[model samples]
Target chain A: MINPQGLMIVLSGPSGVGKGTVRKAIFDHPDTEFEYSISMTTRNMREGEVDGVDYFFKSKKEFEQLIADDKFIEYAQYVDNYYGTPVDYCIETINDGRDIFLEIEVEGAKQVREKFPNALFIFLAPPTLGHLEDRLIGRGTESDDIIKNRIETAKKELEMMSLYDYVVINDEVDAARQTIQSIVTAEHHNRKRIEQQLRKHLLEVD
Target chain B: MINPQGLMIVLSGPSGVGKGTVRKAIFDHPDTEFEYSISMTTRNMREGEVDGVDYFFKSKKEFEQLIADDKFIEYAQYVDNYYGTPVDYCIETINDGRDIFLEIEVEGAKQVREKFPNALFIFLAPPTLGHLEDRLIGRGTESDDIIKNRIETAKKELEMMSLYDYVVINDEVDAARQTIQSIVTAEHHNRKRIEQQLRKHLLEVD
Candidate 1:
């Protein structure tokens, strides 16, 4: 029998695997609803990006303050930029009956798993390593060295592919999006969720 | 991490609850593949149903013979009709990597759960008892006595809702289809699946 409970989908991928793009497509999905995880990052706000919406941009000092206070569920420093996922907000939303979505890097995703063992971890993979490299460069914002560094990071990420639950190849946007949709929809229909639906059903019948 | 090995989704409900219709929708789905569970029955075939396809319609003697030989995994008698899920077929399909879908009645679903505890059981519910009544009447094949028995059977079936894993209210055709789809997808993206996916992924990378 199916159990009915809300599921936590922890989505992670390397820098240029179009995780952001996939999220955008999912946000516009007609039948689904979600609460996005806003990360507290030490990285400088990029052009046109807003704090609290695009990212909760923090200074090195402010980020450290939160870390010392133990406010984040998982935190990491990438190229001197501190990033962390806030725990309370994500948990609250899920408790309120909405599935929480965490878009994080591999390390952070691992941390979340350690903490929330039931959370679903999905890894977004590019069609090929070559495609990932091209996507990083085609973005045009990063310098050659940064692009190269990201590629190396991607290799390490791919090595940790086993750490993810699902490897979604982002070859075709529509296909990949559908994959994500299928996966997420599948999660909501978890055993606990189904049991809940059944309980409601029995009550209605009785 | 998401598990790579797929899941077994047991779609169980009462007769005329549109389990077949829901299964048909899922079968026709383009993005995903599923395996249908073939059943063994002793009920004489009604017109238009095929053997080995609609059911492995067997005689009482043949079914009892198989049972005595211990060839059947699980079997039950309902309204003087003997029905069962053949062990060999389920094993073959499950090993083939597709989720096994069994359109079973409540008792049969419960029995299957005993044998395969990890199977995802999704309860297909008609919108209302009235709707169920209408559906049974719309069949136009059964006698009044059989129709009354089915309606009573449906009521008893609803009482078994708590025994199921998930309950999907199948009201409208398209909406119910989507709900079932979502439920199935969600189950595949569960924590255990994540663990399985991550393990397989590790093997692939290694």
Candidate 2:
């Protein structure tokens, strides 16, 4: 049987919801087989971060040129820095029967949804709104007003949880990582995705 | 948040696809938590098979009366014996926030689908049509004609694979069992089923 196209998995949630932590745990685990889609950014590369490994660093002009060329699956500007996921790598990886993982913000996730509606969208959620507030406060550098503002933003972002296919409560990083892995495994067994190949294999032989 | 209603998991497949073996492996595993809905049958109980353990052995009259009273989720007669899955046990179990597992025939699975459209339908499949034929032939008791007929029936049943939510290829009992377990875990995280409670918890706090 021919190999089916791989899944495009998007992990997105509200800011400070531990998406980065859970993503790190997932990649650090030896069982993870999917390749991470390195993001492109126009921000200045920080010390200890490699240009290609950490991100495909680009200049403002170069990033805008790629954007104008429609090479990004999703992109967003934060604090005057442009960050985007390239469309070519994702498409090539999926076509090669290898899953590609993307960790992006909510707005960028929405854009990917428009482009690849079938992509598996997992919303990493906080255990509770109170817990999210505590996490923001725990950062300690932000003042009370900024923490309150972040909580409000989180509320709005949490509302978008309905848009996701699966919701993994980030109460514990390891648990969230395991749930994500299980979701990916189950998706491969979904009948809608694998039916055609099984059908051809079963019926044609008779 | 209130515990969500448990999933109704229906495991069905073509005859001789080793559904019983896989189901046994699943139930025998320490991690299996779902309750198996013991089937009611009018078939004579064997010496070692205890009532309510192997099956809820009932008289033909009792089985027919239960059928008339709409007590069964699905029922069928084979070789002058009645067999069925009782509806009350499944309903009560799911209502108690516990999953209910039913191992039934494909036709019975189709009936359950009409009654409970949201139930998780898993179709166990042989590795290949040739493998299915080999399994039937390995049964030794069946004549060549019976084996051929069984293979034809299997082909027809495999056509119904599209009706399932997930298809588990029974290439190995342990692998199929693990896949089923993963599918259940993933279904619990499905956003459609858990979104309401999450939304209420998140939005109401603000």
TM-score of each model, paired residue for residue:
0.73, 0.91
- Residues B64-176 of candidate 1 have per-residue lDDT tens digits of 99999877657889878898877776777767666677776677778888988888878787767878888889878888899899989988888777667666777777776
Model 2 C-alpha lDDT per residue in residues A68-167, reported as the tens digit of each score: 9999999998546898999999999999999999998888999999889989999999888888888878866567987787788788888888789999
Q: In angstroms, how far off is A41's CA in candidate 1?
A: 1.8
Task: State the weakest 10-residue window (summed lDDT) of model 1 chain A.
Answer: A197-206
Top-DockQ structure, candidate number:
2
Candidate 2 docking classification: medium
The C-alpha stretches of model 2 lying farther than 4 A from their native spots are: A42-61, A140-146, A204-206, B43-51, B57-59, B78-81, B141-145, B204-206
- Measured by TM-score, the strongest candidate is 2
lDDT of 1 by residue, A1-206 (tens): 23323567887888788887787677677855778888889887778778887679989999899899989989988766888998788878877777777777788888888988888888887666778888988888888999989888987887766766566767787776777777776655444545555446544542
Shift of residue B138 alpha carbon in model 2, Å: 2.0
